[model samples]
Target: MDKEFKLASQLLTLLDTEQRWFTLAEIEKNLGLSDKTIRKMVEEINKQLPSTMTIEVSRGKGIFLQRDGRSRTVSEVISSMFRETIFYRLMNLLFTNVGRFSVEELAGAMFMSTSSLKKLIVQLNNNDLKPYKLRITYSTPMVKGDELNIRYFYWKLYGDAYEFTGWPFTKINFDFINQLITNIENEKKIVYFINSKRRLSFLVAIVLERVTKGKSVKITEGGYPWEKGAFHLPVKALAKVLEESFSIELLKSEIYFMQSLFSLSQYHYYEGSEMTPMKEVELHKDKEEYQMGNRLLTLLAKVYPNIDVKERFTLEIYEFFDKLLIDNAIPEWMTISKSNLTTYVQKECQQIYQEVQTCMQKWHTAYPSVLYNDFHLTKLTLLVRSSLRYKSKKAFLVIGEEFSIRHYIANLIKKEIGDQLIINTSIMKGLTDEMVQQHHIDFVISNFPVALKTVPVVIISTIPSKRDLDNIRKELLL
Candidate 1:
């Protein structure tokens, strides 16, 4: 089951969405296999399926998954997801050590000859490790790179591993970590948004363990400068909890790191020490992260010189790309539910995908030690695609029988996809090519069937259905 898990995930991404009749040719195209090869993957997925969940196939229409009432469970499927052998062992060791162990200690513990360890380090460096900007210096024998990317790399190791029981859950004291999380949440008046909450707890546990080993992260570049401000209150509160639990006050840099966590996950922030949603939660843009973002964009711009990187959303996308490197928002729950969207992005946004692949390859040639997954490449591709359509007109015409109903459908579509799409209203109006081009509308949303010689039109219920929304998302994101 080597690439079997990947096959299951890629296939699931194709069929899971409402445009359910994903063609066999499409599957074969995206996954790079024949019909026979695809069927074998379906069989593998079926073995893991509960009675309520199964992939249903139609010879002419292609495939879709049928869920009988309850949601599909993938504990069987996800549990089997892992890479094999040397890379796995090396990564697991890195996660356990963080900064606690040196190269000599790691090599000795892995029971490998120094030469073998050197070769593996070289191999990893020569591959995807370049993006993390990290390398193994034999002199120090510790992984050294940008601190934020290193932390994200460590988190990704936990993410890529098969065990779903949140590794730190097994390695750390559950009650102690949970209480620390609760103390922060209550004092801050925030919801810890399950997955990220657990990630924060796990991080605290790692810090706690590292502290026990007398390991403390130094205040270096990449951390947001710690300041005594309104946000500092929560950080101070959290630091107090940690001090009580660990019997030591956290260093200034540690408090700065904690401030980042709160800002990123916060639902709202206090303005003038008063809780208000009107004032946006301020996310600190570290000087190093901004430079990293600019450097990456500059590289991509070198490859695609004609594309507009000056757009506000384009800059935002680079920041999004940077955050993906260090963000601790690793989802505790894993599924191929978004595989359809991810695969669609891969296929539809080929230009951006190729540009990113080239950018990564270019970096690899220079750095040679950055590790990344195909999934992240796909995610980054989506970010690039978002910039492609940034603030561009998305919905052209809304056709309906009457004024009230048409306006209502238009509003509903806006409510559902307002963030990703821009809908312009024209009721009882014939959507012509002239109108579409004039408005720069990408697609049409109509309660009635509307035809276009050059553009695509989607017919939907006046109120919009799941099928309607799904198809819209396909057009929007893919």
Candidate 2:
């Protein structure tokens, strides 16, 4: 994604998440964007969005996103924008072409001058393609890199840009791919999640396209030992179906690549339940990836004693490191933009981010070859945050007004921040410092000034406004 589209997508996502009108200052603070840029982005976004959706800006109230019942989601809107970019267009063109083309030919196809096309390739090679050790060759005007990296790059580009929004492979039969996946599921006695199925379909389509073009993967390093596990039969089944349907034969390395993807945690699992058996966990216990996951959990447990080291979380971490250790060319940057995600983690969850960074550093020291980056840190932070037992802060609401007024204020607070706080109500006459200490109140919310040194007090209107609630949130750090 380009800078403008990324910014527009960020703005749209922010608006979608809140689904409420925001002041100009609030938008500026959250997005770290100036007013002028924001206005331009909104204009461009509005032009691209369907008629049923728009970013509505008001002179006094600022801006908010408005969507009708038929409007597409934020992901779909971003995907549509991605399709308009030259990067997506170029990648799609190359995949479909699957062969060498002259710079003039490519430039003409994209309706651009050869000079401009060469400059774009230079930029991509220096930045986006640098991490993958991949680049668009100037002479052939095709993606030139390790076979694994080439396949992985296309998989990620297509997966991130299109996802479930639309199929990018126009020539490939979607039903045929679905049937292939179904046959594998039947043979393996397991079913893929809807998302996993879609992801597998993309991988299959990419493999078919590449294989048909004689672009085969060759495992030069210690190859993936697919036969050691339970995936060989499924791999054979997939190969047979591809050969039967597309009249193309997949090499051993191509089959192993498919096996590696299928075994990833993101792709599939046992049919009946989401849980992985403890016996299976023990089976991989001796593996370095499993041990690494164990060490990470142990280190994190010091900070978060209540962190749930359940089977699912443990399995995911194991599988993550497993992918990292494998020779397959999964990018260290992962799918999302590195800077954007890292910035989010740094701002929103600083402590978790710092701890995960420390853990990553330690892992890098242990295994110097596996390049861990912000993507790994962000993912581990999310996993740790999910496992934590978050305790809600207790709030005592003291109102000097009548029953209805107190009830109304309490209900308003509840509606805004009920999940993060334990709300307790009391009339002013019944409130005391002893009571506040006895209940261990984190903060006090009152209409009148409360003379309590034990806990911080927030003064609000008898009927609280949005500003009043916001103030309460600031005091409580909610």
Candidate 3:
């Protein structure tokens, strides 16, 4: 990330946390910047943001983020800033460039001084590109690295940064790519998830852009199993379409690489009307992802036995593991910013978060190559919590009104918390400890204050209001 992008992201993030206006002094204090710099950053960010969203300034009241249409997230705002950075523009240029270029030519294309462009390349080489062993050689200004690593680096960079919001490849037609993906789906008898289809389009566009520029992947090993499977047919068909569309032939290695990308977990599945790729997962039990899923489930059982690892949950875990493996293999450099999710999980359910962290640590110990981070922990914790089938809480409704009113109150409570609570109605006159004990009531909901010593009592209006439901939720921990 660029320094300006980081500063702009910080400003947007601070504003996103609250809806109220912040005085200039408050903004300066929070961002640790001078008032002048803060104003400049805000102005630049506003220029990048769409018409629907903007940071509005007031004469005396400071600044506020205004949203007249669909709200944009802080990350989205940051990505918009990211696209304008010299670093992003340079990388995007390199990914689509056909051959090596003179330093002057490249700098002129970015409208930057040659010396400044060289310094930027040095910064990228020392920081972002260091991990992937990719570096832009100053002599010719071309990215040099392992072919697969190069492709993975750009795919992750563009995917994380753009994310269907904009088309980075101006030369490639988006509609043509979508049509090609639709053709693949129709021929392969599979349906790509909507988001997955977009991601696939991005990957295909990257591959086409790179390969057409004479940058083709080199297959080191004998090729993946999917190359000879049913999936290869669509890849071959896709290759033919590309050859005809671009007037270029794809190398065999390029075709194999495309096939591997398409076969990645959760991209598409057999069109059996099933939502997940459970059938595909079962067919590859011997795969590392499958074994990792089983290991994770066992670890979850030992750590958090209360969670039910049912079939649906099991498939979800498998899919998650598969994605983890792919991420590990590629070693993406771009940050998939989900800090909001991490914070939410840590605050909402610390116990489950810690449990997931423990399981992830154990799994990492078993397979050191598969590293886990806060992002992975947050995702897995959410999955486990979502799959949990909570035991119902028993509640007794005590109404002192007429029978019809009592039933009406009961129905209202039911409508509010029927999914989590089993409500039993009783008249306040006859409600006693014996009845409460017989029903095993976990809590009591009454129209008036009740003196129940065994169970907690929640007082509500004749017709339960939002506050009443909130009180019930607090008492029952719903």
Candidate 4:
């Protein structure tokens, strides 16, 4: 990732989220950027935005935005804030001056000296472009390696083109673009996520841009079993639209490129529907994704003995693994942070989180080449959360089987909780040792100490006091 974009994005986010004024010291504390750099970034941002959307400063109040209307959405603000950065301006130059352009011409367009332009290209080549084995063939300004990588780079760089709030590709027509997307979606019969539509449109823009540069992408081999049949109609329709729009026929490889991109796990999902939960995963008799999912899970069981979520959340796990296997975007696009998602999973599912770490270690032992990140952990935790949502706990209340008291305490517990807890009242006859073991009782809620060792026991008032119920609530979670 480019440092400039990162700095600008964080600055915009801090201002956007806080809304109220922030002193230079406060902003400096959060971002760790010097006051001079902050002022310069603010200046750069104001230059890109229209006059109506501006940041203002007061004598003692510090800095805040003065928007003409409602606060800008995060995406909208990011797109605009990064628009005139030296990085994107360079991007605009490279993508537009496709066929051939001189170093001087490019530098002039971006208002940069030729030497600075060279240094920037060198920086990009050594950092972001190095991993994909892609380079800016700068002598004549052409792309090297896979055209698909070039497209993905653009997706990460400026994001997809939007009517106003995003990167604007003036050459492409919105109506025509919509028609192509519609053709693909209608024939594929799969619904895209909310972000997919805009992203799909950008890929179309990518194709148009590359074709303008007399380039085409091809993925000749290693195609999945389900890709071709699923991709045919949409691919054909999109090809026709592009050809008609550009007055140029596409090479076969270009068509193959689109098909392969759609096949990537990032593009779509199984149509949203109710899938029945399972007690144990049944290996799919034919589906490859399901089979692969089960195989990984079988290996996972060796790492952690308690591996029920692998099967309990089979459909979710299957789709997740399938997507990760084919996802084409760089994992860098999704930052790995100490987020609420990860923290909640760690706090609520500590045992499972540890097991997942073990499973990941086992995976590395088997295949030492690939690296893992929090993106994988976050998704796994999401599956854990889904699996746990359907998990029902068994609880036995030892409140001395007095008819009135049991009924009253049961009613109170019912009002406090719900079907979440399956409660059975038992008399305080010193408790049965085998009962806890047989029924898989999560915890025993009793008024008197049961002196048990296997299952957790929480002592509570027979009358169900607020403090007692609170203690019971905390125990039930375990």
Query: What are the TM-scores, per candidate, against the unseen true structure?
Result: 0.52, 0.74, 0.70, 0.66
Best by TM-score: 2
Residue lDDT tens for model 2, 1-478: 3667667777888898877898889889988999887887788889999988989988889999999856678788887888898888997898788566688999999999999999899998898888778888887778888877788788888877887667888879888898888887877667778878888889999998888888888753354446665576777778887899889988777777788777763544574645455655775776767777777777777666666778777777777677665533434224432545677776666766787788777766766766666766777787776666544788888888778877787888888855777788754345778888887888898888889877888888888876677566555443
* Model 2 worst lDDT run, 10 consecutive residues: 328-337
For model 1, how does the per-residue alpha-carbon lDDT over 1-478 read when each residue is reduced to its tens digit?
1346666766775565554667889888888999988877788677777677788777888877776645543443343344334556676667566665667777887788878888878867766576566776664466666554555566555544533454543556777767867776667666666666666665666566555555565553343334633356776776777788668768866665655555454243233546443222123244444545566677866765444566454445544443443332222111111233566666666556777988877655643433455666776677665554333347864654577766777777778666767777754245688878877778887777776877788778767886677567557543
Candidate 3 vs. truth: CA RMSD?
A: 7.1
By lDDT, highest first, what's the ranking? 2, 3, 4, 1
Give the CA lDDT, 0 to 100, for residue 284 in model 2.
72
For candidate 2, the per-residue lDDT at 155 reads 84
- Clashing pairs for predicted structure model 2, backbone only: none
Segments of candidate 3 deviating more than 4 angstroms: 13-18, 23-30, 47-53, 70-81, 98-100, 160-162, 188-190, 219-224, 228-233, 243-253, 265-292, 324-349, 360-378, 394-478
Q: Could you arrange the candidates by TM-score from highest to lowest?
A: 2, 3, 4, 1
Model 1 superposed RMSD (Cα) = 11.4
In order, candidate lDDTs are 0.61, 0.76, 0.76, 0.65
Q: Which segments of candidate 1 are over 4 A away from where they belong? A: 1-4, 19-21, 48-52, 56-62, 72-90, 97-124, 135-147, 159-167, 213-215, 220-225, 243-249, 269-274, 278-478
Regions of model 2 farther than 4 Å from truth: 1-4, 21-45, 57-63, 187-189, 220-224, 230-232, 265-286, 327-342, 359-371, 390-478
Number of clashes recorded per candidate: 13, 0, 0, 0
- lDDT assessment of candidate 1: 0.61
- lDDT tens readout by residue for model 3, 121-193: 9899999888778899887788898877787778778866787488788988999998988888877667888
**Tens-digit per-residue lDDT, 139-182, candidate 4:** 66655666666777776565522423453678887667867776
